[model samples]
Target chain A: MKARVTITLKPGVLDPQGKAIEHALDNLGFSGVEAARAGKVIELDLADGTSDADIDAMCRKLLANTVIENYRIERL
Target chain B: MKARVTITLKPGVLDPQGKAIEHALDNLGFSGVEAARAGKVIELDLADGTSDADIDAMCRKLLANTVIENYRIERL
Candidate 1:
């Protein structure tokens, strides 16, 4: 089985990288980009039948900070 | 309107970050993690009714390197 984790910064957190992208876009003549948030995606190839609980644990332990970030897991 | 761009390395591209994560998972006792690939997700808050073509152009010009990565766009 395959699993995907989408990790994003929580609301109210400052994202300098995202801000840079937004500014760059504006400079490149792409107008009307109100904001941008940069995040990460990790795709895992796992053994079949790996439980969702185990995946959730991985996220909590190592994949995300959990304090300033939020993560969502999808099984594929 | 909102849009998401998921950028992933092409299959043949080398991903040292992904490899490091895979090894770290193994060291942390996460078995069954056969492989891992790291990617990026950028969420954009754009003006309403921003044309898909404009989004695609932004991706091509700034968000993704088409020679080495593939990107998927989702409008929300």
Candidate 2:
């Protein structure tokens, strides 16, 4: 089984890297961009029968910093 | 308009970070994870009517390292 875990910073969190990207975009003449947020993607190739609960635990325990980020699980 | 660009390392490329994450997951007791590849997600808020072609250009020019990374664009 394959799954994707996306970890995004919650609203109001300070994202310095994101800010830097936004600035770079502006300098690169992509002024149409209003905002930019950078996040992490973890693509997992798992053994068959890995449950959704274990996937969720993976995000909570290590994949995401829960205090500042939220994660979504997508089974593929 | 909203779009997401996912940039992943091409297969066969050396990914030290991915290997590190796999090791960490094993130590954290997630033995079912056969492989883990880390990637980047860039979420963009754009002006209305931002064309798909522009998004593609963004990825090719800045959001991804075309030499080693492949990127997918998702319109949200």
Candidate 3:
């Protein structure tokens, strides 16, 4: 089985990396780009019969930093 | 309007970062984790009425490294 976990900063958290990328984009002539927030995508190949609850626990415990980020899970 | 762009490496591409992360996870006692792939998520706050086609073009032209990555866009 395969799953995708997307980790993104929570709203109101300062994202210096995203700001840097936005600045670079502006310098590269991509106008009208008001803001950019950067995040992480983690693809996992799991054993058969792995429960969604287990995956969610994994995200909460290790995959995402809940202090500043939220995670979404997609199973494929 | 806001759009989310997810950039992921094409299948079969080598992902050193993902591998490193996986190794770290294993060291931290995350068992049953078969493989890991790392990617980028970029959120964009665009002006109203930005066409999907234009956003796709932006992704292809700048947001993703098409030589090894693929991108998907979502509007919110």
iRMSD of all candidate structures: 0.5, 0.8, 1.6
Please estimate how well model 3 matches the true structure, expressed as its whole-model Cα lDDT.
0.88
Model 1 chain A: weakest 10-residue lDDT segment is A49-58
Q: How much of the true A–B contact set does each candidate keep? A: 0.86, 0.85, 0.78
DockQ of 2: 0.87
lDDT by residue (tens digit), candidate 3, B7-68:
99999999998898778777777677899999999999987877898788778777899999
- Model 3 chain B weakest 10-residue run by lDDT: B24-33
| Residue range A4-73, candidate 2, lDDT tens digits | 9999999999999889888888898888899999999999999999999999998988889999999999
Q: How well is candidate 1 docked (DockQ)?
A: 0.91
- iRMSD (Å) of candidate 1? 0.5
Over 4 Å off, model 3: none
User: For every model shown, what is its TM-score relative to the native structure?
Assistant: 0.98, 0.97, 0.86
Q: List the residue pairs that clash in candidate 2.
A: none
Docking class of 1: high
lDDT of 1 by residue, A6-74 (tens): 999999999999999999999999998999999999999999888999899889989999999999999
